[model samples]
Target: MQIIIINGPNLNLLGKREPEVYGHQTFEDYFEQLKTTCSDVELHYFQSNHEGALIDKLHEVGFSYDGIVVNLAGYTHTSVALADAIAAIPAPVVEVHISNIHAREAFRHHTYTGAKCKGIISGLGLKGYEFAVKYLQEL
Candidate 1:
C-alpha cells in the first residue's frame, strides 16, 4: 500500500517547538521508526508551513495514493480552502493532531479540515500517523 503524511505549518519544528506538549522526538525520527515498523508499505511524508503549498500537495497526490494522513496544525481550525482541498480529493484522509486540540485553548477546539476527513486521530502524538496508515492499509 502507498500512503503519504502531509503535515502543515510549525510541524517542521516538532522536536524543538514545544517539547512539553509535542514531545521531544523529531517527526523525522518517528517517521523512520514508522517506516521500519510498516516495512511492507510505501510511505511518503511532506510538510509545509504554507497553506497553499499544502493544498497543492494534496492536489498532487490525492488522486493516486492509497490514503493520506494529514495534520494541518493551526490550519485545521482556520483554513477553509484546505478543508475544501481535502474534500475535493479522492483518497481517504485521516486527520491527526499530536496534541489534543480539545484539551487546548478554546480556539483550537474547532476544526474546518477534520470535518472533511474520513476520521480523526488526536492526542496520540506521532503515533497517530501509524494508526492512520494502518487504518488505510486495512481499507
Candidate 2:
C-alpha cells in the first residue's frame, strides 16, 4: 500500500526548533526510520512552510494514496481549509503531533482537522509518526 506523510509549518525545523519538546531528530532521520519500520509499504513524504502548498499537495495525492499520516503542526489549530481538504480526500488520514497539544497551550487544545481524520496520535514524539505508519499498514 502507498501512504503519504504530510508535515506543515515549522516541521522542517524539527530538530533545531525546540529539541526539548519535539525531540532531537531531524526530518531526514524521522523519514529514514519510518521507511525502515514500514518496509512493506511505499511512503511518500512532503512538507511545506506554506499552507496553500500543503493543501495543494493533499489534493494532488489524495486519490492516489491508500492512506495519509499528517502532522499539520500549527495548522491543526487554525486551518479550516486544511481540515476541509482532509475531509475531501478519499484516503484515510491519521493526524499526529509530536507533543500533546491538550497539555500544552490552551490554544493548541482545539484541532479543526482532527474531526476529519480517521485517527489521531500525539504526545509520543517522533514515535507518533511510526505509530501512524503502522496503523495505516494494518488497514
Candidate 3:
C-alpha cells in the first residue's frame, strides 16, 4: 500500500521546537524507523510551512495515494481552504496532532479539517502517524 505523511508549518522544527510536547527526536529519525518497521508499505513524506503549498500537495496526492496522514497544525483551526482541500480529496485522510489541542488554548480546540477526515489521532505524538498508516492498511 502507498501512504503519504503531510505536515504543516512549525513542525519541521520537531526535535528542537518544543521537546516537552513534541519529543527530543527529529521526525527524520522517527521517519527512518517507521520506514524500516513498515517496509512492505511505500511511505512518502512532505512538510511545508506554507498553507498554499500544503493544499497543493494534498491536491497532488489526494487522488492517487492509498491513504494520507496529515498534521495541519495551526491550519486545523484557521484554514477553511485546507479543509476544503481535504474535502476535495479521494484518498482517506487521518488527521494527527502530537499534542492534545483540546487541552491547549481554547482556539486550538476547534478544527476546520477534522470533519473532512476519515479519522483523527490526537495527542499520540509521532506514533499517531504509525496508527494512521496501520488503520489505512487495515481498510
The 10-residue segment of model 1 with minimum total lDDT is 124-133
Across residues 35-79, which tens digit of lDDT does each residue of candidate 1 receive?
999998999999999999999999999999999999999999999
Residue pairs with backbone atoms closer than 3 Å in model 1 (clashes): none
Off by over 4 Å in 1: none
Candidate 3's C-alpha runs over 4 A off are none
Error of 1 at 125 (Å): 1.1
Count residue pairs with overlapping backbones in model 2: 0
How close to the true structure is residue 23 of candidate 3, measured as C-alpha lDDT? 96
lDDT of 3 by residue, 1-139 (tens): 8999999999999999989989998988999999998888999999999999999999999999999999999999999999999999999999999998888999999999998999889998899989989998998
Question: All candidates' lDDT scores?
Answer: 0.95, 0.92, 0.94
Residue pair clashes in candidate 2: none
**Model 2 residue 126 lDDT?**
89
